[model samples]
Target: MRAHPAVGDCLLALSLLFVDLLVLLSQARQHHGQPWYVALPLDVAMVAPVAFRRKYPQVTAYVILVLSVPHSALQLGIGSATASCVALYTMVVYVGRRQAALYVVAQLAVAVLQMWARWAPGITLIIIVLIFALCWVLGEFVGARQAYHAEVEARLHLLETERDQAGRIAVAEERGRIARELHDVVAHAVSVIVVQADGASYALRSDPAVAERAVRTISDTGRQALAELRRLLQVLRNEEVTREPRIPQPTAESLEDLAGRVRAAGVPVELSIEGEMTGLPAGVSLGVYRIVQESLTNTLKHAGPGARAQVRVRRAENLVDVEIVDDGAGKARALVPAPDLPGGNGLIGMRERAHLFGGILQAGPCPGGGWRVHATFPVRLDP
Candidate 1:
């Protein structure tokens, strides 16, 4: 029988006490022994502690086993001693296996001595053995259930940890992409603004009209910068639908417009092209446009007043070469290292953009005291 405290203990205690007293009365009548009154109180004493089997299982089991010997010796009811079996079974099922086994051995010894003292019947001995077996089986079943629950809990915990790790990895990847976009937008816009501001400042006293043109370029560049920034921030905030209502991006064909703006700022720029430039990929074309834009802006800032810049683009079978050279005595002045000038993040940004498309960029003073920027990009016009 399963050993549980709620229903099992109460039922077992009541049944055992009633059966023991009834059996004791029948035996006393047959042998002319003591009356039912005396055995009834003793039987109640034996079954009373069974109720506490779950709360203090080992202690209750031991007490019931010890008391069973004297109750059986006194020829009390048969069911009075059976209540101990229920308590012992409760101990084995609830307590640990080692303690349960020790309890079983102690109960067996008490049973043997009681049976010998009164020469108990065969049926009574068989009942005791069955109780011991039942207790062992119940103990094993409960232990298996506990182990299964633990295994399930451990697997659940492992899956939750993996889920959290994946979420962190996703967040890190998103942050990296956002950082690259911001770098591209800010670096290009800031480079253009710095160049136009410098040109306007230089032309203020001698050529007020040229200075006014440079200031207009500054305002246009600022507006473009704000638009790009808004696009990036909208993406960050997950508002992509609203940003779709904004202006489209500038492409390779827009290079002439870019060159016109630089010329309007009072810089003289000569543009030349070679090979079939019509079929370059969008990414490569955008890269070329940005490189040319940044190079001309740098010329305006560092090449001094009245400097001349040449922009050349040559396309071959698998590669494109771009060169921006300025012929001016301003190279020495640009190299003088003005502490107030912005740091070299613009140059770093250009190099990073080139490297991303599998290209290389070189910028420095030429042997004849001019500044030259040369870049090479691999191009795939089609898929």
Candidate 2:
């Protein structure tokens, strides 16, 4: 059977009571002759209340004081008076300071009256009061110290919890940023490949030359997309590596290669440059490349077979503008059913990549029977 808390406390109180009683008996035996019935019985009555001292400290203390009177009156064992002193000490230690103080004054008065009536020594009264005062002060100091330590520990625990919460918030924010980057990379690449593949598939049966070009376009687009994906993964894996190798990244300079691939996919792309293409930042170049790739890919998928596409890159004083327009009918049957392009995350990716370069992208069906994608980036590169 499980023991209740009170039962455990009672058992400890009993054990203390036994030790106190044994000490009292031994002291009495060593100093005084064997006591008569009055002394022995009175000593037992004074010490017995100590067993319940923890449960009813004030009551036990008062009972010991009351019983001390008769035992003293009958000239009982001095050791019995010592047992009453032990009970008084227990009360002062366990009970509140205010109550213990009041009880101490009452017991002192009683002790004084008894000693006066018997003509006891003045030195003994002074010694007994000094002992009681010392025990009371020590107990109060220990209790206050325990309470102070507990408060400090509670505050430290609260601080640790707050620190953990802040760490979790930071980690969640980082994950959100990483997810956005991944979406931009995958959407732009996949959208372009799908459009090129569709155009190539349509030209395969009728035009052998066009069909071969389309196949080559699809292969090149797939390879470029894979390289971009690998670069992104590498950056994520070794985040602490401050310096990166100067690997070649597809940028505006590579537009000719991009146009060649798209033309091979059976979509003829006419490219035009209006401004000097010098001293462009790497990030800006990459952004421009992705925008054009996405636009041409969309043309291949939505413009249908035999679509003619136009790509223009114009650099002004503070801005660079890129525009792609296609003459084929807008969007294939699958894209038309779901204008948003079901399960396609391309358009969204393009916009995000453009935004990263401090630019804006616009893509939709033009007033004419075709589609257009235009992007503008703020130029920050030094001339």
Candidate 3:
């Protein structure tokens, strides 16, 4: 059979029942000689509240106190007074300190009056007071430990919530970073491909040799763009990073090859290098390459017929500078003085790339009928 939750408590309360029973049977002459039935109910009332002392300590104490009056006045057993002492102990352990203090004071005052009425000796009264004081101190110690455990649990819950919040924020930031990388890779390649396809279509009948070269350039640019796209998409997989060999990103050395492809697309391109390309940080190299690549792509799309482009790169002791100018049909599309608010994805992506590496971009229309993009960055030794 399953034991009940209150079984142990009932057994304790039953022990006190025997104490009052023994008083009634062996010490009947000490009272006014009341019968067993008359005194039985009074004894039961006193110990009944003991079973609920821990659940309702203050209520139990008050109930025991009220019951004691008739028990004491009618010359019944002292069970009610004894039960109140157990209530006092529970009060300190479970109730607030102020309530415990109030009950304790009330108990002591009644105890003193009882001792004085009985004319008990000073030593006996002192012993009773000492025993109650010791129980009170023990209850206070248990209360302290209970409060400490509760505080620790509260702090642990708060820390767990903060940890989950930080993880979500990190995931959101990684997603944004991936979006920017995809835009830079796909936008630049698709622009070059579109321009080359147009040139190939027009030159197919009149200039067969030029058309063939544009087709080959388109094929090569498409393959390179595909490889870069695969690298960016790898971040989404759950596999370990080492599962695939890493691909090197494009740097400043790739600019000449890039300009060659743009020239192959029918635009006149002139590339110039003003400073040493060595000793630049990896991020700076990548940022510079993307900036130049994107600016040239924009010129191919926006610059009108008979347009020519120039790319200039200069490295200094503290910074690296870049300039791209195109003399195309500019007045038709107000490419200069780009709106303070970003005009398109191309403009927004360019600014994001520059800002990622502590750089600044200036883009606007040139008075000579074209658009120009200028950017500069601190040549960081370490990323």
Best by TM-score: 3
Q: After superposition, how far is residue 338 of candidate 2 from its true place, in Å?
A: 17
Worst 10-residue stretch by lDDT in candidate 1?
Answer: 334-343
Q: Best-fitting candidate, measured by lDDT?
A: 3
Residue-level lDDT of model 1, residues 1-383, one tens digit each, is 45544577677788788787678768877886556677777788788778777788887888777777767677676644566667656666678778878887887788877778778787877888897788678767876887788899999999899999998998876665456556655665676677778878889999999889888888887887788777667766656756477655555566777777677666788888787667787767777777787778777667777888889888888998889888776547447443233336656656766787899888776666667778889987565
Candidate 2 clashing pairs?
213-264, 214-264, 214-265, 302-331
- Give the per-residue Cα lDDT of candidate 3 at 133: 83
Q: Among all windows of ten consecutive residues in candidate 3, which has the lowest summed lDDT?
A: 333-342
What tens digits encode model 2's per-residue C-alpha lDDT throughout 1-383?
12454465456445544654565567577785445454555556655675676677788888878887886676544534654565566665667777777888888899899889889999989887887777666666765775688899998999899999898997775564445446544554565566656656777787877767666666766776677666656655665334665346667888888787667555789999877676788878877877787777667666777789999999988889998888887533323432233234667767776787789887766665577778899986584
lDDT leaderboard ranking:
3, 1, 2
Candidate 3, residues 83-183, lDDT tens digits: the string is 77677778888897799889878877776776688786888667767877877887788788878988999999989989998988988878866776777
What's the number of clashes in each of the models?
1, 4, 3
* Candidate 1 off by > 4 Å: 1-95, 205-213, 235-383
Candidate no. 2 TM-score = 0.48
User: Candidate 3, which segments miss by more than 4 Å at Cα?
Assistant: 1-95, 116-136, 240-242, 274-279, 335-339
